[model samples]
Each structure stands twice: as C-alpha cells, then as structure tokens.
Target: MSPEPLRSIHVVAGVISDARGRILLARRTEGRDLAGRWEFPGGKREAGETEAEALIRELQEELGITAEIGEPIINVPQQYPDKRLRLDVRRVLSWKGNPRGHEGQALAWVAPEKLPRYVMPPADRPVVAALLHPDRYLVTPSPADVDDETWLGALQRALESGVRRLQLRMPGVDAERRRRLARAAVEASQRAGVEVLINSDIGLARELGAGVHLRAAQLPELSVRPLPDAQPVAASCHTGEELRRAEDLGCDFAALGSVRETASHPGGSVLGWEGFARLREAVSLPIYAIGGLQPDHILEARQHGAQGIAAIRGLWAD
Candidate 1:
C-alpha cells in the first residue's frame, strides 16, 4: 500500500498599511510554535471559510479590527518538519477601529522598506518579498551572438521598460569578454537603480559589488553564502533537494522551471504550473518561474506560489 499524503495547514495573513505606508505585524504569544517571532497578524483557515473570510475573522480576533480584504498578494507553500503550510497573503484596503493586539501579543506598524529587519517565520518571509520586490526577474540572453554595444543597448531598453531585477548570464563567452560585459552591465544597472546579478561568477560579482546568481552545480561547491547578506544571492533549482540546499545556503531568491517548453531547450522537461507548485511547496524562498514565461504570466505565476516570472527572450527587448 502507498503512504498517506501530507495535509496542508492553510493560513491566511493580511497586509494592513497605515496612512504613512507602514504595515502591521503581530508578535506570536509565548507557548505557541515560533513564539516571540513577529508575523503578519493572521490564523489558520477553518473548514468552509474562504481566504478573505478567514483573514477577516483572524484580524478581528487577533488585532481587534474589522478588515476590508483586497486582492491576493502571494500564496506561499512551505514544508516544516511537522506539517506542510500554505500561507495566503492579501492586501487590506481598509479597516475599522484601531488595531490592538487582543491576545496579549505586541503589535507594531513597520515601513515596507524596513520589513526585512524584523525576524519572521520561514513561511512569512516570502510575503515580505511579494510586498517589496518586483513581479519580474529578467535573465539576459547570452551575449555570444550579439556585439557588446547592441547587447548593452537592449539591456538599457529592458531597464527602461521596468525591469527592476536582472541576471547577466553569458554561457560560452570568453573570460575576458564576460568581465567586460559584466562591468558595463553593472554600471548601467546601477545608474538605473536596478539590482543586477552576475551568473555563476562569484569573483566578478564581488568585484562589481553586485549580486550573484548561482548555477545548480555550484550549490555543492560552497557551504557558505558566497557574498555578504547586503548583496543578494540567487540560484537556479530544478529539484526539491536543490531548492532546499539553495534555501539552506541563504539564497535570497531562486529560479525554477521550464514550466513550459521553450525554443532554447526544446526537449527539456516542463514542470508546468502544477510541478512548479509542488517544488515550491518544499521551501520558503521567493521563486521565479523560468522558461517560456512572459511578463503577462505574473498573475498566473503568483497563483501557483511563484514570486514572478523569469525569462530571457520574453524579457529581452527587441
């Protein structure tokens, strides 16, 4: 006989912003799991309750406010040792009355930018990313075929088109040329206020004062994070084990896919949305669905527990 499947504990959380743009957080009372940790004020979704209804009830019970729930933000699926957890977060457009912790827990309103400073539960971390990070993480096409000027010009166009996060990946390019292009890309990205990552080259990433995006093979080579916490580090993962390792190494984000077939890898196995969700359930990292995805798929990606879409051709401005 087959083994029993794991059951997921569906949890709902609300992002309630104040007039000054600060968001609310509540401390978990002692004697509870993850006690003393600060988290978005919410609770489990009881049977027969919609996500909005659950959030509304949780807010009233925990924060003493009647919330007006808004659209979905990001649904995170994470696996803890004891149980599988799904954290569904939504924006609270408005609420009635002042918010006071009704359960003897402490409450604080935090600025969106300062959210990372507060220690939160593993499942709650991705909610912070969904609130603050961009919905698209652009991975550039290899620069082997294009001239430096032409490639850089396209990159400039991508930045102008609202690409806030990017990775410079140039497979098969010579070491000298790769460094030169990375230097140029880093300069351009800094000017545009975009976060740029160098693919699989820790030395270059450090030299440029940029982030690093590790290839899957590089995960086993280093036990510690290659750069400082101030510099974002990302990874490419195909399996749950790989994703777990990436999380263990403190990768800020990850790209997982071939969610659909693409011209670049015609015969590559596709994870589709379901497969992506399955892998996403194993970790708490913000993930971008790669391969055959465009900016238009952001909503669908979010629905399947993705931070956003990561693409090369789809994002590279023609």
Candidate 2:
C-alpha cells in the first residue's frame, strides 16, 4: 500500500500578556526550524486536548507560567515552503509566576507598537496587523427618517474624517435598495480611499465590488467563502469561539465587542476594559472593539492590545 499523504493539522497559540499591556513572545531555540525568530508561545494540539488546554500546557511547559486562558482571538492557516500549520491563537489575561525562558530560549515583553521592530515568523505578520488595528467599525443604518442622500452624506463625512474602514449595515432596506446603497457607498469609499464592507450581502457586495462583513448570527451557516477579489472579509464576533470560527474560515479580521454599553444595543452587557483586555489575551486576530466606542477612547483600546477603536458614534463625532 502507498503511504498516506500528510494532512494539515491545527495548533493553538497564546498571545499571553500581563496587566501592563505587554505581549509575551518567545525566541525560537537554536537548531530548530525558524530558529532566532520571535513568536507567540504555543505548540501543536495533542489528541483529546482542547485548544485552550493545549495553550495552557504549552505555556506551563515552555515558559514556566500558569496561564489563565481567556477567549480565543484568531486562527491563522499558513503554508510555508517547508510545512503547513494552522495557528489557533488566544489571549491570556491573567497568569501565575513571572514568565521565564524554561526552554533555554529568550523571552521578551513587547508593546504592540514595538512589534514591528522584532524579527518574527512570517505567519505572524497578519497577527501584527491585527494587533495594530484591532477594532473594526460596524456602521448601522440611521433611522428610517434619514433619507438616502443624508445617509450617503453621513458616510462621506465619516470617511473624510479618517474612518478608514466601515460596514454598511442597512438590514431593513430591500434587496434593490440595498444594492443601490451598496453601490453608492462603494463609490464614496473608493473616492475617499476608504474600505467598505457590506453586511451579509455577498452577492450584492460582489456586484458592487465591495467587501463583505458577516454578522455573528450568519457565521455558523457561511458555506460560501467571501469573494477573493474583495481583499478583506470581516466578521462580528461576540465571543472567543466565534472569533476562532471567523479566522478559521479565512476572514481577514473580526470585530469583537460591546466593549462598552451603547444605545444601539442597550441590553447588551458591557465588557468593560477589564473584560476587553481578557478577550484580547486570548486571540491573535486583529479585534476591533465595537459597541459604544468614542474617538477619545482609541488610545485606551490600543492600550488594551486592540488594533484600534471602531465605533459608529465616535468615528462620526465632530
């Protein structure tokens, strides 16, 4: 019998950090593959071990720290010339014992902004982008009283004011209306060099030559991949599991939130800074803090290890 082909496997990673907002990275040991490169600490998943459990074990064995794993952040599927690996990364918020290089390698505490300065594994570039600009803006449509012209004007104004990314979320609009609006938004965003993601309208987004943003409700049923031509596909993830699914499905980014309470979803529980930080420790995907974000809070979001702050109100604030 012929030998079986090697199958791709999944592995979990830990983007472990402390309360001071420094990420823990390990230098690969000499003589190992990709030696001298810095990477988020983690290893392959052992049979019957959950992703979280694998991360905890990796941290304890490799760094001598007891990791209190939080929610997952991102799963990166990377194929190198030598090997293929799926990196399931999570955020680690709390842990016991100061991390030491138990594997006889070096460790460092790096701020997100300083990540670019270090030499890291090639698979970590997207992770770096996510860390730098974590938050994503989910732009809900204005009230019915707002006309198409007014909505376009609002979007235009927001784009001009430096809202680099947005999701056009007019769910109540009929299909025809949605297509027209998507076209208009795409035009405006192209003119201003901004990116627009149409909420849950893959076909319409394709027709309009725009990106797609998947809502959490639609995540489980996403059978078709977002069109590759769109460049970036994003998702709204309320929990670690959802974020993992989004990343596993090849989404370029995800919006994780209700970091703060807001009028948009009044009943949604606020995951304050502490909660947001906890989630941050779990994943390596770029997470944009959604729900109740304001412009002034951008720095605070960054401090918590988010890519950036994403907001409906704050991005539009005058």
Best by lDDT: 1
Q: List the residue pairs that clash in candidate 1.
A: none
lDDT of 2 by residue, 37-143 (tens): 99998888999999889989988998888888887565555555555567677888788987899889899999878987888875675567866642546475553
lDDT of 1 by residue, 1-318 (tens): 996677779999999999999999999999998999999989999999999999999999998898899999988888777788888889999999899989999999999999999999988887888889988999998889989999999999999999999999999899999999999999999999999999999999999999999999999998999999989999999999999999999999999998999997899899999999989987889999998998889989998899999999888896
Most accurate candidate by TM-score: 1
- Candidate 1 lDDT score at position 127: 86
- List the global CA lDDT of all models: 0.92, 0.75
